[model samples]
Target: MNQTDTPDKSDLSSISQAAGKDNACGTNSGTHLSRRGFLKRSATASAGILIVPSFVVSGLGHTAPSDRLNIAGVGVGGRGFSVLQAMENDANIVALCDVDWRYAQRCFDHFPNARKYWDWRVMYEEMLNDIDAVVVATSDHTHAAVAAYAMSLGKHVYVEKPLTHTVYESRLLTRLAAEYRVATQMGNQGASDEGVNLMVEWIRNGEIGEVTHVEAFTDRPIWPQGINTPKDAMPVPDTLNWDLFIGPARMRPYHEIYTPWNFRGFWDFGTGALGDMACHIVHPAFKALELGYPDRVQGSSTLLLQDSAPMAQKVALFYPQRDSSFGRLPAVRLDWYDGGLQPLRPEGWPDGRNMNHRGGGVLFHGTKDTLVCGCYGADPWLLSGRVPSVPQHERRVATNHQLDWIRACKESPDSRTETKSAFHEAGPFNETVVMGVLAVRLQALNKELHWDGENMRFTNISADEELTIIMEEGFSITDGRPSFSRPRTEPINAQAFAEGLIRTQYRSGWSLPPMPA
Candidate 1:
């Protein structure tokens, strides 16, 4: 992990006028202060030599820090840029931080007045006093690291979906949020959608009858997968800080094939299709049926790559019977498909009708009727074409996902609003999502793998069974195509292998804070 990134000197031109300008929080704009400068300022204020702004002390007639949050964005490129834009109306944009300045230039241009930093750690250190919340939209591998550090400092965090790269990190972040007692939300915007609420309400009203099984599918992996690691070393771009992008993952040579949007296909950086889409597609099933954790998980995929996810895969998660408010819900099975796969279409379904025009959907096979919805739980309906009218019991949010989080951050202690995908819920839910990823990685077990959710391990596995997988790898380009390798076996420990993947190892200088005692 490289920690040598410094602030852009060109962005410091506004430091002289920072104190004169008023921000949305009704406080003076903040400048990037060095450690010595920050300490001196703190000492001066403590000695009562600094004049405090009226609004900082009280709201009076203006919006105070109490009314609006001072928000900073860590990966203000791509999705992070959009998240910050959505939040700009409600919060003060105090700072913008990103590892790659070239990619994040659009955000920098858009929020010109906001302080900019190349590294998030420096941003946090310099602007800790000014920032009230952080929006983290970094690669999946670093989500936990960035958010955990922010939460440790009592900063509210909104992280992008597929919360963490590993199941253990999900559990860690969830617990840390509670220990810190700060408002936190995962960036699964669909969780706050009207569609998810409707799906939950319909299921609660028993409109779907008893959901015997559920199937969710998506046409993801828009990026390349089922391939070997790129051996072609490329020069790191001048505008990018390559080490920061790698974060906690082991350092690898820079390659265009691994960056921008393509990281989703890689194992070390992203969680492939399951992690990319399940959080959106399977959310309704989890919410509507209260699918907490699966007792058993199994998967099969196309040739498992050396350093990336397969091109396509299918995973089955078996849940045991659990008591619910209505009664003991029957044990259910959820089958997930990605990379252009779909479940056997429902019987008697019209061929002319598309399953989901959006290329992804969820199907709840109830004893009486089959309920289905598109991506993000949109347009939920029954296959019988007779959707029942259920009284809406779920709270509806008029604001978008980002604003909902902002609203929660501004909530007074007397009345706190929990964001739809608050970490307490999103964390456990993410553990389930990444478990599917784990099953994909360990498909070599070649049997239905038993999962002990409470213990966070796979039970019923024997050491007698060798853990080597037969992989047909393509490492070189031959005649304009990838040359293939014959099936080869590599030995591995089935039990320890599963455990190691569950809890990812961090490179030095990038460790998660220990769970609070």
Candidate 2:
């Protein structure tokens, strides 16, 4: 993974382009009626100058223009497309933007009335006054920049999971959401699920006693990782704007390996298996246990790579005891696994039965009993084969993640209903999740790195701590026997390396927008 000490200082204001020059599509009439125009006409009709249909005035059969949000979607080719589809019933899908038009064509076809654009900046430039909210599902590296710009405009935003690429970016978005007072939600769909709420209720009610340890695992990296960067550049797709796709990260030649879903494995573009899945898998634990931050973390992996994450990794995060209104909470340990790794099966599980419903699940070993939950915290059950029933504590919301955010967006700012995974909460949860990423990346440090969450620093190790980094061979069958290799070692300042990864440097012309005054 590449790390930079100082970020580029240039701001987005410096990147300018002509608006209305490259719009891909618009209304069927060949003339655009902006939201401002609709409001003006509605105002005129109220004065008896025009007669509006009863349905339009009362929103009996259709939503009134005044009652619907004009929403825009960025990176609408994949996950964003699904989000917009969910919001269509509640809001007006007014605009769609993506770097690759071919990839986003399906979304555009579904909402033919929504204007299309290759660049989000241009979409915002042309329709800033018309938009009420934004749905951002851009690549991990660009989530911060996109969400920050939207929040700065005071537009409610729904962003996809992992929340952000780096710890610094997650922290920045959390602050921006509050500063702008925008209703914000991160797309961890399971956060809104009844199963997750039940887990929280059960754990908080002490149905399982105190959770002493947790094992969260996933089968991810469904894409390539633990390999050297592709050396040869591939031709850029005709419909793709490569520069826009690279947003905020250092520019590189276009390659099929880095886009359309494969980016998850690359450090610069994505956050690997942990970031992709942990937001859903660990959310229940974070909520039920009030896991604020881990004081110490350590990790081991199949093989650490320079340009990407390892194929498999096991990370342990240690949290300190805490005092709460109900009582004092004991310190807990969280172990995370990914890339085809899983925790041991509960003792009473059938010999040949699967450990988890799918490739991932969470196991909570408490003082009194053990509980296990499937991915997304679904299908939780105690070791004795019973789903705990506890008093409902968490307020439930719309089961659809995007719809929940839409409800939050429509709320009055002064009395907003917080989304289940609001930025303020998801942001901190994300920081905790990505700390495992940091541990995995710095596995060579081979030290239990102590963290100071509030200060965003490592407390135990000095920046100048020198050490010999060694690479161990991964396990494989060779001629029906074990294999080995002479380990390669290098000397470096380990603590400094760990610190650089906590944050990331932005490429020129791609800084996160500053908070609004």
Q: Candidate 1 on 316-434: residue-level lDDT in tens?
A: 99889988766779899999999889988989677788886465899999988898899888888888888688788788989898898877776543356688999888998999999
- Highest TM-score: which candidate? 1
Provide the lDDT at 73 for model 2. 93
lDDT of 2 at 326: 52
lDDT of 2 by residue, 178-249 (tens): 776678899998889888888888888888899879999998878888876677899876566677788778
Over all chains combined, what TM-score does candidate 1 have?
Answer: 0.86
Local distance difference test scores for all models: 0.78, 0.76
Which 10-residue window of candidate 1 scores lowest in summed lDDT? 22-31
